[model samples]
Target: MESVFEAFLSFYLNPGFFYGTVLVVLLILFISIFYRLFPNSGFSILFDYFFEKMYDFFEDILGNEEKKWIKTYVVILFFVILISNLLGVFLEILVPVFGNIADTDVSLLKKYIDIPTADINFNIAMALIGLLIIIFEQFRALGFGKALYEYFPIFGKNYLPYTRGNLNPIFDWPLFILVKIFDLIISLFLGLLEIVGHFAKVISLSFRLFGNVTSGGMLLAMLVGAISGLTLTYLNFEFPVLGPVILYFQSLLVALIQALVFPLLIAIFIKVAKFA
Candidate 1:
C-alpha cells in the first residue's frame, strides 16, 4: 500500500499540492463564514438558485432515474477542474503579495505553484476514472453477461443460439456448425476493434484536457516571465502591464471553458453508454 501510494503521488507530481491543499482549506473556511454571516441574504439565495439551475441542466441529460448520481458526479468534477484552473489566478495574486514578504526568487515561486489540470498525468488519471464510471454504468444498466457480450459477443452463450441444442447430424448440424464458426470469427475481429476503441477513449479524453490547460498555463507563464525578465534587465520599475492583463483574462476564460467542457464530455459519455 505504501509503494502504491508513492507511485500514485509520483504520477501526479502536483506542483501546487501544498498550496492547493491550503487553498482548499481556506475555501472551506470562507464558505463557513459566508453561511454564518448571510444565511438568509439575497447572495445565498442567488447562489442556491444558480446551483439548482446547473444541476437541472445536467439532470435533464441524465434523465430522472440516474439524475441524482450523475448530477453529483458532474458537480464534483466541475468544481475540481474549476478550482484547479482558478489556482493559476490564485498563484498570480499570491506572487505579488507574498513575493516581497517571502523574499523568494521569481523562479522559485514559479516552481511552487501550478495548475493541477496542466499536468498530463493528472488529466489522464481523471480520464481513467471517468472511463471506469462509464464501464460501471454499462454493467449496471446491461448486467455482466450483456455487457460482456457487448464487448466480445463470441464468448456469450446466445451469440449462436442454434449451436446450443442438438440438431439433425446430416443437415441442420452442418449448417449450425458453419454459422457458429462464422459468428466466432466475426466476433473476434470486432472484439479486438472494440478494445482498441476503449483505449482510444482514454487517450482522447486525457489529451483534450491536458492540451488545453497546459497551453493556457504556458502562455501565461511566458507572458509573466517575459515581463519580469525585462523589468530586471532594464532596471525599470514600470511597464505597459497590458500584456499580462490580457493574458490573465484569456487564461481565466480558457480555465472556465476547459473546466466545464471536461465534465460535460464525461456526462455525454455516460449518456452514450446508457443508450448503447
Candidate 2:
C-alpha cells in the first residue's frame, strides 16, 4: 500500500492537493457558520475568554488602544498560515499534470500545484504584508516626525544637556559642533541598516512558515511508509490499520504547533515594532 501510494503520488494526478484545498475552504466555511449560528455557547465562552485575554495583553504593550486589534490581526494571519501548512499533508495525493511526464512530453507549471506555502513567493508575500502593517502601526503611534527622527538622530547646539546661561562659549560651542556632526553621520548609517532589516524580515518569515509545514508533512509521510513496510513484510496485511491513528495524532500536534507558533511570532513582532 505504501509503494502503491508513492507511485500514485509520483504521477501527475495529485488528488491530495485538490482534497486539501477543498478541506481548507470547507473548514473555514464551517467554522464561520458554526460561530455565527451559536453566537453564545460553551465554545463561544472559551473564545470570548481568549479574546479578552489577548485584548488585555496587547493593550498593556500598546497602551494606545484599550482594544486588542493587534491580537485580532495576528489571529487572522495565523489562520491563513495554518490552513496553508496543512495543505501539504494531502498535496502528495493530488495528481500533478507533469508528474509522469516523459522527455518528449510538453511541460506545464500548472500540472503541479503543491502546497502553496511551499513556494517562497507566497511566504515572502505574507511576511511583506505583515511588515507593512507593522510599519503603519509604528507611524500611527509615533507620528511621522518622531518616527523619522528615531532613524536619524540629528545633532546641533540643542544636542547636549548644557543651558544657554552657561558662559563657556569657547569650550561648549566648538565641542557641540563637532559632536553634532559625528552624531549625524552615525545616525544616517544606522537608519539605512534599519531599512535593510525590514527586507530581511520578509526572508525570515517566509522560510520559517514554509519549512515548518513541509517538514511536518514529510515526517508524517515517512512514518506511514515505515509502518506499512513493517506490516506488509511481517504480517502480510493489506493495511497497517494503525496508520491513520498515528498520523492523526502527529498531524494534530503539527497543526497546533504551527497555528500557535505563527501567531505568537506575529504578536512578538508587533511588540518589537510598536514598543521597542
lDDT of 2 by residue, 28-136 (tens): 7876787789978887678667656755555555454523556667766666666666555444333122233466322233234555566566677778888887787
Q: Return the clash pairs for model 1, or none.
A: none
Off by over 4 Å in 1: 1-15, 25-29, 93-106, 155-183, 224-237
User: Model 2, which residues run further than 4 Å from truth?
Assistant: 1-26, 38-68, 86-115, 154-181
Q: Please report the candidate that would top TM-score against the real structure.
A: 1
Give the Cα error of residue 15 in candidate 2, in Å. Answer: 12
Question: All models: lDDT?
Answer: 0.72, 0.63
Backbone clashes per model, in order?
0, 13
Deviation of model 1 at 74, angstroms: 0.6
User: How do all models score by TM-score?
Assistant: 0.72, 0.67
Winning candidate number (lDDT): 1
